[model samples]
Target: YRVHLEHYMTELLDLTVAAFDYESKTPTYLLTQFLSGIDWSVGTVNLISSIDLKSDKRITILKALTLLAGECKGELDFLENRVVDLKSQIGSNTQLHLRYDKNCDYIEKISDTSQLCTRLYCYGRDSLTIESVNEGIEYLDSAYINNYKYRKEKTIYTNIEVASDLKTYAEAYLAIYELPFLTYKVNLADLAKREIWQHEIINLGDTLRIYDDDLSLNVKVRVKKITKDYVSENIYLEFVNYLYLPKFDNIAEEVAYLSEVISNIVSYDDPTKVSVDAIDDLPTIL
Candidate 1:
């Protein structure tokens, strides 16, 4: 008992420190490794202490991630101000139009494959807030697109879906995109006839389709990504709401602690709300 308790106590101390080190949203993969190694079979005293410490550690990391998001957003706004200033500098020899849209470049700075979840957290102290598609609506109202616009309401009929193990995500996505929102008014015939939505479709790729209850209504959408595991796609549906983007500020904050995505989807899956800033990834907004 003495040896076991002593060893666990020491481990608890080390883990506590590890957690604090990551309190600022720094994504050190080594910490994930360390967490995977935690036995947690120690006596009550050590086990309890470890759990409390870990929770605190994760919370701090989340706050740090939020700060990082703010920092990235600040960079974007700074660039926007510069563009405005440039637009104001119209001289006599000015061209027909001043296409001063460098926003894409700033967006790329943040969206660079490098600034993905882990790296994003570690990039700065004052991170950005990852709001849900519903929560970030106000931000997009000022012309910053929060959602993508579909070419038109298009739907293809198929008993296919993309996730089995991910029931919550699958269901939530369906609820958000499935004609239920638009009252199943999407046009099924036009989608198949013109196949504009399917224009981007390739073998083993995701294509957004609009589904109507009776070919009377139209719901616009785009298919984002397909599951690598589901080949037949018979019961696996993959889709993204061209109109709704789920914000993940808290979720992003938690990324520093979680080594996987098991909990992320569960945290926020309600489909009723739409977020405009979530359109950051898509090319166009309708």
Candidate 2:
């Protein structure tokens, strides 16, 4: 006679094996499965109960896990604290004062005046005592069109003789070659491609934040020049002198020390000068 323990063994106990195997293994198999299952089940239940299962709490947990698994080798809280300390250092080290005036029309008028044709005349006597005149003139077209259909661009070439009388010219030429503006290529591949030109995206005197991956630094800059390559679909943005972001823990202190060293040479006591002394002062804790 065969007796089936269907409901008890299979349903209640959650047995995977058939009745034949269960009957053969008897108490050994049942005891092992029961112990292992209960051990894992209890541990999992305790873990879940320890953590709040709310949406915000779960998100926080996920973020912590992501940070722990990421390539950066530091505790999240420690990294945050480090960032705060660096910001404090930067605040104490650098003074950035910006002033804006409605001078666009004035600048345009000056530019137009500078591009006006200027004629120069030099007189010399010929062999037969006949008077001869030499004239040099240059100008930018007043009606120059700049649009999607027609873009006007020009290249300027200048030659300076390094004669004994032109010592300043020679020095300037050498200095130009050594300058970062002439040597550095601000080619950012990721930001090179855009739907519109740089000028359309950002106007003159606009502040920009640029990041250099190689140096792992951020620089605050202002737009100065924009070059576009229509055929290559590449845009190059040139920036004015920039301030580097505080990177090291002692960078602010170092900057302060340097400023002190040159304090005598640099002065801001003029009546017209804007006071930015409060920029570096830390807030007092209450």
Q: In each prediction, how many residue pairs overlap at the backbone (N, C-alpha, C within less than 3 A)?
A: 35, 0
lDDT of 1: 0.25
lDDT score for residue 113 of model 1: 19
Model 1 Cα lDDT, one tens digit per residue, 38-152: 4432111101111111233443322432233232221110121111101111112211110113101110001111211111101112322222322442111211112334212
**Which one wins on TM-score?**
1
Residue 202 in model 2: shift from native, Å?
Answer: 2.8
CA shift of 118, model 2, Å: 43
List ranges where model 2 is wrong by over 4 Å.
Answer: 1-184, 188-200, 242-286
lDDT of 1 at 84: 10
Candidate No. with top lDDT: 2
C-alpha lDDT values of all predictions: 0.25, 0.26
Query: Which pairs, if any, clash in model 2?
Result: none
Lowest lDDT block of 10, candidate 2: 102-111
